[model samples]
Target: MNGYDSALFENRTVVVTGAGRGIGAAVVVAFLGCGAKVVAHAGRDLSHTEGDLLSRVPQGARSRLTLLTEDLSQPEGGADLARQILDRTDRVDVLVNNAGTMGGRIAAGTETREDYDHILDLNIRSVVALTGALLPALKAVDGASIVNTVSISGRSGGSAGSALYSGAKAFVSAWTKTLAKELAPDGIRVNAVSPGTIMTDFHRRYSSKEKLDATAAAIPLKRLGTADDCAPAYLFLAANALSGYMTGQILEVNGGQLMP
Candidate 1:
């Protein structure tokens, strides 16, 4: 939706985490296309960007984009990323807390302490740390927006081996609302986009084709979602011009799955 409104985000600064691929990449592209200066945290390395994000970016947009590789799953990962962004700019118009993963399907009974710690650290702690660290920058601008990437699993409980991941997402969902209340007076809107069964590397790594196909069949639309499908909701929530009165809400892009 680069053409959605080329000037919607003109002169704005957007920061997106886990933007090297999938939904994050699409969001980055959308913001860049709308003329926003973007700081993209491209996961732990640049390898993922080669034939994906890097190729899709317009040549002109490159001049306005900054890519950083950081392992947000680590203890200090979020703080590190915030420091990098702060070094470059003092204001952030939009902050997309989209860096997270299920890691892998570690069965509930078989999960170890390390597994639990890592999952919580990656999905929960990192977001809190990053957002807290960047509060100053976020508040520096008028009507700043924070769009988090939650999951439908957070509501449905997800499939096997995703208990922790689902719970973590639920935590973020609640946190979003709380932050919204706390930040509203500061003119910062906090919201989220919860994607369901998106056709991205996230599923490629964690789900089998048989399972994904079965899910698609169950959806009212009878199709799996794509990264592009979920990206626009984020833009809508982030752009004050599009959703100025919207905050502390979760937009589900699941093609009619779990209407509640």
Candidate 2:
């Protein structure tokens, strides 16, 4: 099959976290277009933007879509989310742990223990815990893929404001590599996508529009990335025919901000 098949995920069931907005929403739409049954989970109630996107799916595809709401940072929440999906379907062909937060208050001596815990809980811990809970369903499929949304900060240290957030994503990147090897025997591939300055509401927590524009200008591509730009990497990883032999890899889609 082609790497970007229009029907790439046909007859597959994929679960995506944080699907109410940004990259998560984009991933859900992409998979749906590829004919996958998507379980879209968001931390809060769906917004008008998300609702509109969902409405665009074809009628026949509507039944293939399921909406879920839950805070995945909690200890029990991860497993609970998995159970909810398993309750509906016997198998999950893909698991995209794309839910994350930008803890932008971690300057020198500014971040407290609570701040550290919250960031880690949302970024690193939730990904690992949720994946562990859903492993069985994923393995039931002949070949499944797990995609984690990491950040450019994870590769290199972040600015003072993003210290803790960067650290948490770094842990995710490292853990993804390890899990890829451990799960290879089960025919499950694990990978991460590290994006830079995406044009999404995700940055509102960290800076104003003016500041964001200035940062975007600093990148070699002279612009910020977008959710659309980053979604294809996840699609690529999730397509078994395209990336069946790939695992433990980090795909950077940062508009040339951090080239390795």
Each prediction's whole-model lDDT (CA) = 0.92, 0.83
TM per candidate: 0.98, 0.93
Over 4 Å off in model 1, which ranges? none
Give the alpha carbon lDDT tens digit for every residue of 1-260 in model 1.
Answer: 36678888999999999999999999999998888999999999998986769788989889999999888878998898889899988879999999899989978799898888888988999899999999998898898999999999999999999999999999999999999999999999999999999999999999999999999999999999999999899999999988999999999999998898
Residues 54-152, candidate 2: write the lDDT tens digits. 655667667878888877667667777777877877879999999888755666787787787777788877787789988888888889999999889
Question: In model 2, what is the error at residue 135, expressed in angstroms?
Answer: 0.8
| Candidate 2 displacement at residue 174 in angstroms | 0.5
**Global fold similarity of model 1 (TM-score):** 0.98
In model 2, residue pairs whose N, Cα or C atoms come closer than 3 Å (at least 3 residues apart or on different chains), thus clashing, are none
Best by lDDT: 1
